[model samples]
Target: MSDSNTTVFTNPSSFILLGIPGLEVAHIWISIPFCAMYAIAVLGNFTILLIVRMETSLHAPMYYFLCRLAVIDLVLSTVTLPKMLSIFWFNSREIDFSACFTQLYFIHCFTVIETGILVALAFDRYVAICNPLRYSTILTNRVVAKIGMAVLLRGSLLTLPRPFLETRWPYCRTNVIAHTYCEHIAVVKLACADIRFSSYYGLLVIFLVTGPDVSFITFSYIQILRAIFSLPTKDARLKTFGTCGSHLCVILAFYIPALFSIFTHQYGHNVPLHFHVITANMYLLLPPMLNPIIYGVRTKQIRDRLLHLLTHKGT
Candidate 1:
């Protein structure tokens, strides 16, 4: 273990993140709202998961993907919010190097997995909309299960290297992380050794995991749009668009902030550290909160079922 006295300023064992300016003072003010958001996010996604599991009508491929999405949202939220809430309520902001890397690993892993699942979902929509006749045969339970497995495996493999690389570096100096949650790049920046290899590997993983997935999703949507436009009835087109609108909203909610965060981290780090911290929280917290709402409000079936489920318990 490296001691603080011997460590260079740049190669400290840990960093002291300044956190959001005034966050310490605002902790009380923000805790209630943050807790509310966390509760809503968990409950909303859990409700969707439960509904999908219990409702026989939702046994189709679409709902299967939705259930998987709910699981992802639950996990994504759990990984970040609990820690953040702890910090706010208890003022326990300190994290060790190993724990930080562990958190970073899962955060990146789940983020990539969700992206892959979204791609799979886009393809599912394309098949359902563009080739409705063969949809059932093409996206059967077995195939969906396989795709789910693949998504998990790919995400795990891609993100595994990040933590491994981080562990190999010696931490001799700072320990304070600026953000509430442990982020992979931020953790990497604290390493005492050279991180050129880590950065290169990170770039490669990003391209391999997210780049192609987004491209495939875009392609699937393009094909879906083409097929929708070719339909004879306007009602059919409108219905199809409506079905996909929720998913598109979710995809945008998840990816746009991610892309913006990437851009800012790469180019805008000089702007203001607080700006980056806010964006990081937005990236981590917003998707899980928004996903259930997008699906619930957009899909009448889900909305009606949720309502029934909520109301029927009292009777």
Candidate 2:
């Protein structure tokens, strides 16, 4: 490929990601699995949303936050999976520059929003556990709605600059994105202009959004653990831990791979391309898949309600 037709990168337009010559073979092999995962993620998250909406008994602050989470998971998975599945199945891995940027915007937006939602959920748990007498008055439906709106607004504001900055750059080179979806870093790296400012801004936004969120979550859990330990009876302590176990499991599953992917992409770029791709997909796909299962098995109310719904539907 000619230099004029490629972006100003270290590599040329014909550069194969991960040193693989073409994506045709990989696409064929990955299509089936990707399709299955996409289907499962969509259906599972949708079911959780429906269950939360329909079950009046489950319409508490916790379930309200859960419903919000289900929506976020659905949006997050939907933003990337369908496009990815299409690429794999149709062998049309090409994405228009504008569409790629749009995808990148939403991907970052949903990710930020989900992080905020998780933080909000942690706060909700904290209120319930630490201030049982005031929990009802504190976490009313109106308050949850306001929190949801704020989270969405913050996510949108933080990620809007990324795509806006990307659009200003001229893409004079090949448009082939090696990854399945148009990731923020990957797309920005393809720009023909200096991206140091953009990168720094991106990192700053990430830190602002995730740093305090993760810290608050950790603090909430610490206090929860302390409260559990202080319970006079062994059974009470066990029950308290058991009640929060599902949330903790989901939190770990969501954050650990996410941080790993971030570290690998930023600092461990020298690692194998296949490894990066696998970990990236795990970060994108695993939380949605595991979240429903975690709640279903760990939370008695959700599990019983889901089972009842299934049995009633069968009849």
Candidate 3:
């Protein structure tokens, strides 16, 4: 990298985040829903973690993955919200360059982690459905530990360069981010320098990690569907449907907002800027709120456990 690339900016070192431009009058109003969303996300994910920890029967590979998902969702929700809440509730929008890049790094990390997690959860379902006899043997506690470590390593390694690359870019324009949070493309677009390299690499990272993970998960579900159709009994099919449906709901929630944000940001040139910004917020906040509800409502095991915990507490 050229020294010019890495040279400290003589201009303001801090950036102002314009939270929903032209919606200034509505920020306080907007924050009510945003605050509600964060509360639901945290309470929901935290309950998942607590149930998974408290219920002995829920310690299987599926629940283990669910537990990790809750952790990631909680972290993802946290990383952007505190700053965002400040912006919405207190009009505190300025963030130092280092803090902006740090937020970007963590947001990227959470994306990778969530993608890896969905893949893992899909694999867990595939094993349970297609090869029930061997599910326990294949995904032993040791194997689960190894998988957890691998996902963490993968998420951290692939995204670590993003902040450095973004930081080295020479910035000279108005130091204002369009959205509430520090996302890779959002930050990269602010640089006075060309960002083609950074943009392509961001796409490459998505392709290398998330694209493959989503593909494998989709393929796994296809095989699982085939296995389900071959089941001899209707109850067997319904039982499988309940499990797969909840997982698919989570997958859709996580991916749809993600794809919407990516497509609109890339190809939806005619799309309004606020639409993209709102979609970005949805991309970060929706899954954390929805994942627990989907599981809690659809999964018999979790619902039963919640009931059991509640009934005992009432007694």
Candidate 4:
């Protein structure tokens, strides 16, 4: 609130990112694991993309959705982790105003994109399992392309307003963000003006994006479960249910941490600052690291193809 601490203009020249508040002393130690996770995520996601692109038989709606998810994961992590690591390793905390806003937009936008893609994946399973006979017809290349476009547009357009809305506010308060990246709430809280509209819009974005996506995913799975159970043979039921296992794991890995991070940011006043930073980082890192591993391990086709690729390279 002090004028001396405030920026004179609407936007500050740059914002300082405090990597992790209480854990600053341990930053080097922390970056070790964070760097490892980043490496794994990068390698795993690229492998998924490569394998899916190379294998002709894997060119179906399901794999196409997986490829989309991989790209989202890569972008999601890349947007945040490198900057976070820079802060941790080199104590490089200053980010230009425009660069920070760009990071903020990409982080939220891709998060929503990931959420939408999860719903698409759920729907792919629903059609594949519940309506096996019509899977190919219902989810043709054209239809899949349309769904991908819709998901991309929905995320990009919805989050486009965030940076603009932020720029409208004059940041008269301190410009130090206490988390790794330019998180929306963290950055906006530094504004001197009334932030009620921004707050409400944030909640609205969640409700509009996450609310419907979660509902659709749940509905799709219910139908999938019903179809699996109705199969005539136990073997058929088990075999069919097995197909959804990787997706289920992926959904849990993605949403559980994400929802935790969101709710904690909204309401967990008593929680430690380090807890928040760690949770936020985890939500971004864990899914990207785990998603490809989950699919590679659980999906036989991908696993075999991955093995074949490795073997061929080795030979």
Candidate 5:
């Protein structure tokens, strides 16, 4: 163990990720479900992209947003899963210093992008249902392109500071991280220098992303509900509600685990370290795995097109 005075500002060339602290014995067993989730997420997200790409009838603001989401989910899962599996399956726990920060950047970057996309999707649904006549006029291809650009730009700019901030800290305490992957907070905690700024900045990033996005999504849904209830008949109301249900489910799937993980990591004093690790991984995995399935089952066009593709692929 190196002391703070001697090792201050001496960055290690590489860091050892402990996979899951206290669960080394069960790493192999834990990997089984993680592998399954990764496989399903990859296949499902790729299938979603392929289906959206090939179907001209599916060309609309909603489907376009869904494609953006599929791409985000694909990249998000790809960023963390393989490395995690390597640690678990092959015992490859060492990650280069720069590589760890890179992983940290992409993981948080795409997560913020996904949140923005979800908000955009909610706005799309709000326009489609609440202002049907203006839907085409409002969310044109140009407008959608701009929205996509904004989401990417915001996510990139916000998360770009994370690696820089983390790298500034002197890792004199240890190079062993208790988590499976290079999570920003976990990596920052190893620093011997004052980490208060890093911690506050992390909270700031979370607040800036979640504060406005959640408020907007909630406002959109509230208006959507008002529009839904004012429908002249029961069937009309049901139809509108059903249309928004899948997006609602996806939003819940994304936010619930994510918020839980964040809160537990920050404040859950009694929570086991293993539980934090598992929840962190789950927040990343569950949304990507469930998003496509929820959309496929809930959206009639996607369901029919997916079924058609599967059935005809054999012939």
Candidate 6:
């Protein structure tokens, strides 16, 4: 028994990330789209950050939350994608123990922080629509700063236990992570011990963060819609709803894919491994890529700013 434990530490213990398991022959081919998406995701989110910073007119609560969200998206896209592209482009799949855990921490941290920012944005919309008279007074600069800090600290604090949890388990089984990114459970599965505690804690964290977050955001929108309908003018109704349309679309895009991935991971026992892994990858990458597009196309201010930048560059 002691000999086995010693062997587990000294053997081929570094994780071999099986990125799209059976598609080894086609990995180089598959890298093309991944590379393109990574570039777009990084560039788009960076543009959002830059526009928010440079445009003094955009220093409102809405744009402030957006700035925070853009930061999270950039980190999320950056942390997960380069390594994944490396897997595809160069077949670099071996990840050491501490490195894998570090990746896992940031991946989840960004996810939870994204949810918090979405909720913060939802509250901003709700106040704007429901109590327009006090919107500015209520969500002042100080209040907005507090909320941003809260979102950042909350995500950091909640997931702080992850490294400790991961450290408890020793990897003695095959060190091949089934997915490209270092997901908590995927890494935990490589442990030889029972995983009930880790699994339940993970579920608890997900439910605690995402459950209330989704519900709160949905409720905020419901209130916003009702307040819009109460407005007397048709133009008022259209303008107010249109203002929120982009956020609504964003909520749907993010949650639909995320929920589907979660259900498929938990219940789709007979699903193909590559399909599951690819879907997981999509959940992380797609939002970062599409979020900037959705905001740029739907939000007039961002759209006009982006257009002005482009036309100026063209000239």
**Per-residue lDDT over 1-315 for candidate 2, one digit per residue giving the tens place of the 0 to 100 score:** 343345454333332222122545777676677677767877877888888888888899888888888888888788878877776666555565667778778878888888888888788878878888999999999999999999999999988986887787765455555676776666666667898888799779968988988898999989988888999999999987787888888888899999899899879967876677767877988888888878878889888888998899899
Clashing pairs in 5: none
Preferred candidate (lDDT higher): 2 or 5: 5
Whose lDDT is greatest here?
4
Question: What are the TM-scores, per candidate, against the unseen true structure?
Answer: 0.92, 0.91, 0.94, 0.96, 0.95, 0.94
Taken over the whole model, the C-alpha lDDT of each candidate is 0.81, 0.78, 0.87, 0.91, 0.90, 0.83
Model 3 steric clash pairs: none
Tell me the tens digit of each residue's lDDT in model 5 across 64-102.
999999999999899899999999999998899999999
Give lDDT tens digits, candidate 6, residues 130-170: 99899999999999999988888988888878667766666
1-315, model 3: which lDDT tens digit per residue?
A: 133344455445787888886787898998898999999999998999999888888899989989999999999899998899899888998898898988888888878988998999999999999999999999999999999999999999998886787788777756777888886677776687878877777888978997799799989999999999999999999888678898899999999999888899889999888788888999999999999999999988899999988999999
**Any residue pairs clashing in model 2, and if so which?**
5-173, 6-173, 7-173
Candidate 6 positional error at 49, Å = 1.3
Candidates 4 and 5, the one with greater lDDT: 4
Task: Put down candidate 4 lDDT per residue, 1-315, tens digits, no spaces.
Answer: 244255455567888888998988999999999999999999999999999999999999999999999999999989989999999989998899889999999988999999999999999999989888999999999999999999999999998886788877788667788889998878888888888887788788988998899899999998998888788999999999999999999999998998899899879999999999899999889999999999999999999999997899899
lDDT score, candidate 5: 0.90
**lDDT: worst 10-residue window of model 5:** 1-10
The regions of model 4 sitting more than 4 angstroms off are 1-10
